[model samples]
Target chain A: MKMRVHSSCSAAFSARCSRQVAPRAASAQAPPAVQVDDFDFQKYVMATAEKVNVALDAAVPMAYPETVHESIRYSLLAGGKRVRPMLCLASCDMLGGEESVAMPSACAMEMIHTMSLIHDDMPCMDNDSLRRGQPTNHVKYGDDIALLAGDALLAYSFEHIARETKATPEQIVRVIAEVGRAVGSIGLVGGQVVDIKSEGKKVPLETLEWIHVHKTAVLLEASVVTGAIVAGASDDDVERVRQYGRNIGLCFQVVDDILDVTQSSETLGKTAGKDLDSEKSTYPALLGLDESRKIAQRLNEEAKALLEPFDAEKRAPLVGLADYIYSRTN
Target chain B: MKMRVHSSCSAAFSARCSRQVAPRAASAQAPPAVQVDDFDFQKYVMATAEKVNVALDAAVPMAYPETVHESIRYSLLAGGKRVRPMLCLASCDMLGGEESVAMPSACAMEMIHTMSLIHDDMPCMDNDSLRRGQPTNHVKYGDDIALLAGDALLAYSFEHIARETKATPEQIVRVIAEVGRAVGSIGLVGGQVVDIKSEGKKVPLETLEWIHVHKTAVLLEASVVTGAIVAGASDDDVERVRQYGRNIGLCFQVVDDILDVTQSSETLGKTAGKDLDSEKSTYPALLGLDESRKIAQRLNEEAKALLEPFDAEKRAPLVGLADYIYSRTN
Candidate 1:
């Protein structure tokens, strides 16, 4: 009975196109292809991300174990979209709170995200040699230092959230636990493990969906959830945003898989088609590229729908983000 | 002037011989060594560590991304003495408090320590093949998973403290900052950085002292200081005990150097002679064997002196710990 409920709600969204289930018209409200140029939300997001990036660079010191500290610095300074943290800051803003109130959480999420990237790009895991248009952390600093730098960043993230943020201790405590849950065995780490194990194997579709949800989606959801918590958003409000984040996170990854096949490494700043090369199961691999794109369009609509109760002025960026996730080619 | 004061203090303590520094005189005047043994203290520490270990084990589950989850569990459950956490637990007992109050702090310290160990044993840092008589985490889990595991553990440490401890929010905030300093550039990571940079070089004694004190002693001192904080001990008292811990931590490392030269891997549970082979400026390398022993002895005396204000019953184990450190051949 529990399994059916679990399969119906959270897992069903990802499993919509499976042969066992037919897609309904209600679930098929394909989001309009909003041109990226029309929304200027990208500019806001990019500007917000740039501020967080600069803040992160200023925050992490250059002084560390010489061999490993350089590696940590290299990875942190390596550029990315900083989407998760920017989303958090935006979420707080949407909840009628100051961005400063969410800055620490923003920085922490970025650090945690960067740490994951360092580990994910190592020779032993994804074994990629590049990130953000440059050599990956292990490639630049060697494996050992890369590993330690990641650990240092992770440690610093918690400390930063707890100390630098203005939230009360009780609130900090809640965010801290959520951060842990986002990355622990049940969060990002849990998802990566399954991804690795399923590589080159014909695994069940549900298992693959689990991997992406726990690994990629949980942290994304956590970003909004943490921001909402800090901004004093109601629990129901937080849950709605969480659901919004979940659909968008998966939609984001589905777009990524589509891009892996469609885009170039130069365009993506990371290995393109590498997932396919590794024989990893992806949305495109399961449902074909056209079907994956359709699923992503559907999920984006669902995500935007979840935000209907939110004030329209506040939710513009979120709705815009759903469009952005599906529209990005790289 | 500050440098001179630091140098004089270090030289004064570093110059003394071990035999002259042993607490034989103090123990003889107070209580017999045999009478001072507290079996219950050991049992209490063990019990507390066990409870934390159980909580940690249950905390990390093999869920989605089973491999990464398992990888995190592999490193976390890998056995060690749980000494850092024990220090927090023991300090609480010394201040007449229940282990429950200190348990979260204890667990947090252990997690930070474990994260360091995980990184330290990586191929880039210490490059150690073994830890706690087992293959290093990276060796068992691969560098990527090992890196991620350390990150998850480090971040989760603060999470555990913030969520689980009964201390005030202000106190939890303070503790998080303290732990960050101990783990960051000013503390363990900084020391490690210097140590790595100084490898095979003729570094000044002062710089070497900074490396050990920051890298190793800071966290060790933090364990004791945090325990006192958890018990609401006065700042002055905490400072005094911190000095005590600092002295002992340095002595402990000096003793460790001596053992590395004198003991076999079979007895020490780690490969010995790495310092000698690596040309790391250990105590034995800097002071010669006879002088290093004397230095250890003197440091031991200074450590015990700080505990004079505490009751003999409360301080016996701490003092005993000093003796046990030097007594160990391995």
Candidate 2:
């Protein structure tokens, strides 16, 4: 309640102008494990992701309304890197909260992320048929079921957080506000509508960044920021973490763009070169591959620098994540 | 917090079997304006709807993301009966809470209701073109914007409730939980999926009831129940309101089925006889018109009976609303 909820809602967009940071680029090398030698980031990711997967499974079971649940579970559990949830938990951990405190919000982030994917893959939207080495949600469940699955997942994301999160009423309400704003029109859906409209058009560089920032970066920002709020981070701390999230979020997509061109479909696990094949503008398409790589490096570095004032031990996970995103193969 | 959250989620369906209330019928003569002689229920509805419209407009402004916001406002503000918001406010009023206490949530109910309509009208769903006498949301906004508009409206409903409600955090959180569950799988979305699957051919009476209960009745139940919660209604009180809501919710839809056959599209202000046109099962189609009328009357009577324990004057709106649903023409 102490924080400005509306400001947080749009800070992701406004902060972009203030920071004047190059949006993102793409490339990967070995993770800079030296950020925290003893942290064992890889093992932490596996353990945390395991917990997230288990909770997500319980969140939406194969209940009597079987078909929709089946579709929701299919894509939700369809094995991805789970970068968003990990960032949420790690952000919460950095602020000295018990993992359990932010676990529900962390799970909620994945649900929202999963819902977006399910909807985006519909025939009326992106029309992609393959996701995560399997058929897209619409292909498997038909468009209507897939659509309802996404809607249900989106609703449940907020429900799960509101019902399960162990936080103050103020914090819980703020978290819901943040999560809701993150995915609403000005956030994910807004970016998506533009992306749909921009397809096959030679969109300008700013428009492309606007689309990526809103579509891809906003939820990632919400994931980390909501986790921080659940953990009782100060307003200053929350704002700082917001910038970190924004950078990594954009970087994650830029890396996906780079990998789309550089890697094969087999390595990406979904369709590769999808952006290029569809004539969609990406970081590499707009900024060139080498410049995109430099921008990605700068974003990853900026993301890490924002974490400098926090406890080295506590912030190690976040630091490690930026490196991981910058270095991951897929 | 004392009331069971999940129970409210499915209480609309379970209470149906326990009560063995015939799953709604169809007819309306006129609203029983005598429920409270001085109440002037028509004025109450119009006045409450105007307040809700203004609040909804402010809740989502025509911001920078012009297209998506326009799509959201297009269907949202395009005008409808505003039954959900009025029910919410009336319930809150009956429970001795200020109208302002539930106004935001009331608007949210409309927003969620609007989102459903937008999504349902898409080619991937029911594929309608006219709503409230204007082109459907997707027809004007395109399929992508309409889809995203629905998604944004749904998300903002929770955010609006969380940020705008003046209730205690626990109360606000409970409201969020109730609204979320109402629209989630066990609620609205659960019903929608079954409905899509049940389309064409002949679905059993039980299957049809399940769809109506979930798709139509669940959110109405949530509307009144959430208002009761925001007003600090006790668990027993909440359950009482839940039953009343469930009956009236089903009753509302049954009346629509009847009206579909009896009223002209001009009177109904949209496509008439859509149910029969699509071979969709309906109360009148299965139970005969007279039987449907009798059932509608019985449901209205039963809904009123559930409010007998409360003060008559305070509960006047509820009684008036039940009568109004049964007696409505268009």
Candidate 3:
């Protein structure tokens, strides 16, 4: 396995670098041999994420009126894990494609995700003061500017995919459709509405599950599937990647819910027990701690299973990613 | 013209349908027919608007985790003029293109526009209590939903362009870029930021122009250019169409300014003099009513001149549209 370990997080991800799936048990198991680690995949994914940020920034304020450019820039550059876009680039690499072809779509996915976050933090909605350890746009720039910024980012994401990259016409079209489906009623936005509506009400478990799957999972699916499509993967391959993304996304959320309960605000960069504070439905809230933990473990395994057909080396980063997701305490 | 008239208002339009461009001055000197008055364009644009609305209503509430999606949908479906999409569809007609190719782009444009409006009405922004004669989304659903609704619409707009339309991928891509440019900081969002920043301060005339052109005119330009592009018009033809749209857009704003001063709330269906009440810089404020009126007239004439090369029949609707734009008191 090739490695591009940044010193700051080295200790934390050393075992992860080997690309071997971590043992599900809490007790320390010896790390798997490093032979299967695919360093190129991780590097490619990160590099593409950076490139996407740059492209997104360049494409925005310049394309809009200067008055609102700074606000748009605020959220566009707001740092995050860049997970969704990384999924796009990594999946592309895993399927025998270069990042260049998939870069636009990768950037687009991030733009869409970032836009959602910006809007989600507005005074009218979440009214959140902070995100990813920074003041929300509405807090920094005021609500109007924040709103326009999010709007610009969303609109610009599609333009970036359509105009910035040279993907095949069919690919571009498919990407657009995929993006729409993820963001539309059956996907991200739809999920958001139901989630909001369920607030203060005791939501059915099925309803809660549907919300998570649509709002959070759909875009995750889009991120991975888009990469596969850009790489010209077969439909079956795309579906497999989507399944992997879905499991990982859910695992990621479940961990987030757990961390909200267990971690300090200082580490999480958000209020601890936010879900509890808000009385929002969460896995642990619905299933209890032990049951939720089991669910996360099962999901991690399911995600791993989806990647089984790919070369062991090609699948390393993804498998490692599943472990890393489940491992996050904050 | 092959026209489908669905409503009583639209039925009148078919009766008066003529492919020939009305003599330009004839409309200016006499009462010009407003297409919004014409039942076909009115009904067609309206139906398209409704379609967009349905999609918006269905999609915006999908945001996951509950509270978010509810917040997004509450405001997005509130009534609007649906002008952006209508302009897009009208532009397609001017280019002799089928509506099928232009429908998605038209809907996307409206979504972008609606996103802007929703954000503008937030409690932290204009903080308006009413929109389209109804309680603003924030006023009804709370600020959170309004914020999310705007975000969902913006993201969905691009997705719609990419996924729903039958236009070629290149066309979809181009439309996305065109619309994105209109929404970005350099465009509507940028103008808005400047507008907010410049509030209570004297801004340069150039800066003010920059704000309006990017914020308002760019989308208008995009509306027409996208229509032409999807319709497969020649570049020169598209440029010509854009010139026409540009003139009309400016003229429309000028008229709006006039209406803001002269029209009553009952006639306008929204707050009248809201611009003056806010002390916002407007054409009437900047240039005074008489001069603004003249400017609108000149703009209307210039807009007509751009359509001179179009076959006389194809130019009729636009010429009438220009006259109606300038002549309207509200």
Candidate 4:
């Protein structure tokens, strides 16, 4: 497959090129010669995000006990990049799975992601008042309701997948077990605990990597792997997707850390410099900005390499997603 | 299938005799009448509680990120009646399943119960400082860690069941789905929202029952049903156990409401008069104390009646558990 560059990048990504060693040159060196320009990465992301939004809107409703439902809906329905769900859907699509079959798991991934955000923004946690350009759940509802809403979302995530997925019971069970592990103590919560304890301390790079791997990478890995499992991918294929997910997952956080210092609060839609303000060790803090950017670029390339063996056309969206995750820094 | 009653009631239960509308007379009317002094209900409860404690102690380890594990262990290991787990174990035992096969789900029940308690004790929720005669999780660990710990437990509940359950994958999936429903918006979380919303207001008896059914009964229902499911119970058998669980589950809450009015905080191990202080509707608040006690007794009998079809000796623990739940108010 011949590779060509997409000419149009979003304005948000424009700033990324100036700050780092050239990413395009690095990505150009390794490829199965694919025509990238034929695949509109931005259009794919926006389309997938739109579908995910519609599915998510239907996933949670404002029912009885309106406050709790409202609290869950408020954060969930609020707009985001929809990266997790998009990744999930794209992975499923690449494996010849119907979007309808994968929709519930896709929505479940988003719900899980939203839950972490809701709890992470609690007063006792990050004490943040804003998220995604609006008041956080705790700010809109009280802390008790916010916490409950997060919990409801977490529980609902598993229920939604089990109830809605058209996959076989075996696939559904595997998905549930995998997703459960991704969010359990040894996963998201485990990482958050370590991150919390390490705050304001001079932390080792190994510890920082541990935190991100558990907190961030595991869930992303779950998202991609669940989609593939639902689509009935073989073990080898699933493992390959998992590696791609892990690489891009870590890259997602590394870029996020880079944006914390580089972007304005308006552009990021969250408090800029909060990481530095809290003295939390980040990729940029631990490694210099140039080193961090280079690492993120390398991770993005490695994630792409994992997908090279697949049909280039089928893997286009995923390949593009890795670039988008890195390109967000612009 | 002979049915018998235990003659000696604990001192706490002696007072229940006069207020209840002749529970003995109601029970005596049922068939398979045998000696009342044969089974020791209290002994069975204590033995089952001890086994549950040992299983729970091994369920969560003080691994790395000891803080979250500690927070989970702190509340989980803290003493409670272990009523849910006992019911689960008893249900599985009645179905001729090994206790080892049911232990994971039993531990999951306790974990889920502890999660609801921890979140309920948050400052913004019930705002209670004491639980199980010790400081609540939020009081011991900061609210942040407590919230995370609760989330961790909820996720781990599913993981523990999925990973540790010896049942078929289909059964494990069904259990996970059932539990997710139990704790989701339509179950524990939903009931809590209504309870919080109804605070300080005059709620109807219907609404009070709704709150108790969803908030309390569902988890207990899940506990028993999951155990039966894990044991590969027949559909008819599962349905019977579910009914038994529902009756006792509702009975569990009604007795709790009665005790809140009749017992001391020291006796309850958590603050008493909380329902009155918060002015939230309870069974006793909607119905008179005598009526509530009568309802609790009636529920206990109805629960026992459902077990009449099963082998009496096999169901002894469950039958005795219904008595223990009601006897707690004594």
Which model scores highest in DockQ?
4
Residue B254 of model 2 has an lDDT of 84
Tens digits of lDDT, candidate 1, B181-274: 7887667777776787788987887887888788778887888888888888888888987897788788878888888998788777778899
DockQ of each: 0.46, 0.70, 0.50, 0.74
Ranking by DockQ: 4, 2, 3, 1
**Candidate 4: where are CA atoms >4 Å away?**
A1-5, A10-30, A33-35, B1-5, B8-37
Two-chain DockQ for model 2: 0.70
- At residue B28, candidate 2 shows an lDDT of 68
What is candidate 2's CA lDDT for residue B222? 91
Candidate 3 whole-model C-alpha lDDT, 0 to 1: 0.70
- Reference-based TM-score of each model: 0.86, 0.89, 0.85, 0.93
TM-score of 3: 0.85
Query: After best superposition, candidate 4 residue B107: deviation in angstroms?
Result: 1.2
TM-score of chain A of each: 0.87, 0.88, 0.87, 0.93
Global lDDT for candidate 2?
0.81
Model 4 Cα lDDT, one tens digit per residue, B1-330: 323345644454343432442344335545541223356665666778899999899889889889999999999998778889988898999998999999999999999999999999988788899897889998889998999999999988887887788888788878888889999998999999999889999998889998999999999899889889988999999999998888888998998899999889888888999899889899998897989988988888888878777776787778777776776653
Error of 4 at B17 (Å): 8.2
Categorize the docking of model 3.
Answer: medium
Which candidate number would show the highest TM-score if scored against the true structure?
Answer: 4
Model 4: DockQ score: 0.74
Error of 3 at B236 (Å): 0.8
The Cα RMSD in angstroms, rounded to one decimal, for candidate 1 relative to the true structure is 8.5
After superposing candidate 2, which stretches have Cα over 4 Å from the reference? A1-34, B1-35
Clashing pairs for model 1 are A65-B193, A66-B193, A190-B64, A190-B65, A193-B68, A194-B65, B17-B294, B18-B294
Q: What DockQ number belongs to candidate 3?
A: 0.50
